[model samples]
Every structure is written in structure tokens, then in C-alpha cells.
Target: MIEHRITSRSVGALGSSGVDMSFLLGPAVSSINTVRILAGGGLGEHPAETWQVFYVLSGLVEVTGSDDTHDAPRTIVLEPEQAVQWAPGEQRSSRALVDSLVVLIEATEQIPSARPL
Candidate 1:
């Protein structure tokens, strides 16, 4: 069987992501990563590269995004088992309310609601 240590990719320096990011599935239809954020640390004051989903794996996080369909910004407090999605070109940002781990998924194509882990 093939084995991939997805989280080990974050052993080095943090990338431009602002948070600690480790790539999993990538350069194909979509890319998946694990983001580790310390309390008070965060990611982005930038637009989403594509359709993106932030699924909280542990701890609590505050996510805010701007949508073209709405005048006011959207904000969510994501807890474990909770997630949020952003459309392409939307402004997205996330802040860690506590030390947290999040599964980040990004794709230009549609993402199925459920998939084998």
C-alpha cells in the first residue's frame, strides 16, 4: 500500500500561507492540506484561488469571507466537525480562536459532499 505522511510536510518553515501548511493531494483536480494555527494566529486577507473548503479538525476557529451576493461580510465560528466553503474570487480569512488543526481543500471543480478518507 502507498503511504503518505501528509503532516510531515510542515516540518520546515511556514510558507507564504501565513499559517503552517502541509500539502497532501495536489496539482491535480484539487489540493488538500493540514493547517496548524496557534491561538491569535491566522491566514489571509486575500481572495480564494478557487472553490475552497475549510474543515476544522480540532479546536475552534473564526472564519470570515466576503461574498458578491451579500453586502455584509460573513463570519463563522468553526468548531471541530464544522466547515465552511468559499467560492472563487471571494475574500476569505481565518483566525484561530485556540490552537487548531484544519483540513483545507481547494479546487476549481466541484467537490463532492462526501468522499472516502
Candidate 2:
């Protein structure tokens, strides 16, 4: 069995200022991948094919979707154990109101590149 401990030293940058991540379960996992992240008011834009689930370990996150620019942004305050899922083909970004820890779960199998929504 594989077991490990993650610390701040293990986190890496996520293309945004003050956002860091650690891979708890990588692409080697046949079904799913899990990651832990620490973020501070940073924004990230990703393509739509990747489906994701975000669980807040602490603090609050405001999520906005790129598809609906005129729509009001969604503010979700997640304490420990709270989580949310982003549907496939939805472009989303997030920011942390305060220091926050989050867990991201993604499918290990690659989504088809031809489909973008």
C-alpha cells in the first residue's frame, strides 16, 4: 500500500500567485486523482473537458464561470469538509478570501480533446 504525508514544503505553484498544490493521487491512479492545494486570492482558467470536484478544507472561495460572463459570480464559503463539483465543459475559476486548503479530485482517464464546451 502507498502512504504519504504532505506538508507545505511539498506544494508547487499552480500558475497563479500564492496558489500551491501537492498531488496526493497522481495519474498513476487508474480511476481518479486527488490533489491538495493552498491558495490565496488567485485565479486560474482551465479548459472545459476536465471535470473536477473541489472540497474546501478551510476558508472561503468565490467561483466564477467563463461561459457566463454577464452572470453574477458564485460565492461559496466552505468550512472543513464542504465540497462542490464543476460539471464537464464548464469553464471555472476561483479565489480565496483568506488562507485556504482545498482538495481536488479529477478523473485519471483523459477526456476527449475534440470536445470543448
Candidate 3:
């Protein structure tokens, strides 16, 4: 069995902005189809065709979609045990309102393309 504490060393910073992501599972582990972990702060803009699941471990977060910049689309406040999912091609971003912990699950493979009409 694999077991370890979530430490600073295990955590990583994503993109040019946002929080540190603690990877509980990586590509090396074939059993885990996604990357699981704890994250904080804003996770910038997401890349196209990437699926993500965010689970709140503690505190709160604000998620905004880039599609609607005229006004606030919606804010999802996630507490401990709460979770949310994002599909491919969705333009979204997240930020920690308070010092928080979150589990981010992302698919290891790219989303398949659909046939042209």
C-alpha cells in the first residue's frame, strides 16, 4: 500500500499563476487515472480539452468563466466535502477566498475529437 503525508515537497505550482498543487497521484501510478491533490489560490485559465474535478477540503473558492466578462457569471462556494466538475473546452478559473485546501482531479489523457460533419 502507498501512504505519505501531504507536504510542501509533494506540492507544486501550476502555470504562471495560482496555488500550489499537491499531487497525491501522478502518471507513474497507472492505477490512478487522474491527478489527485490539495490546492489553493487562483488556478488561472484552463487549457482546452482538459477535464477537471475540484473537491473542497477546507475553506472557500470562487470560480469564474471567461466566456462572460460583462458580469459575474456565478460563484460556487465550496466547503469541506463539497465537489464540482468541469468538462473539456470550458473556459473557467478558480481562486481561494480564504486559506483553503482542495483536491483537484484531472484526467491523464486528452479528450477525444469528434468527427467532422
Best by TM-score: 1
Report lDDT per candidate.
0.69, 0.49, 0.49
- As for model 1, its CA RMSD to the true structure in angstroms is 11.1
Order the candidates by TM-score, highest first — what do you get?
A: 1, 3, 2
Query: Over the stretch 14-93, how does candidate 3's per-residue lDDT look in tens digits?
Result: 43444554433334222223222234557777653554555566777766653323454455566655555455676676
Pairs of residues clashing in candidate 2: none
Q: Tell me the alpha-carbon RMSD of every candidate.
A: 11.1, 13.1, 14.1
lDDT of 1 by residue, 1-117 (tens): 001123422344444443554343334347778999999999977988777778788999999887555687878788876666666877778899999999988887535452322
Q: Of the candidates numbered 1 and 3, which has the greater lDDT value? A: 1
The reply for model 1, stretches above 4 Å from the true place, is 1-29, 114-117
Give the per-residue lDDT of model 2 (tens digit) for 61-96: 655553333455455455554554555676677777
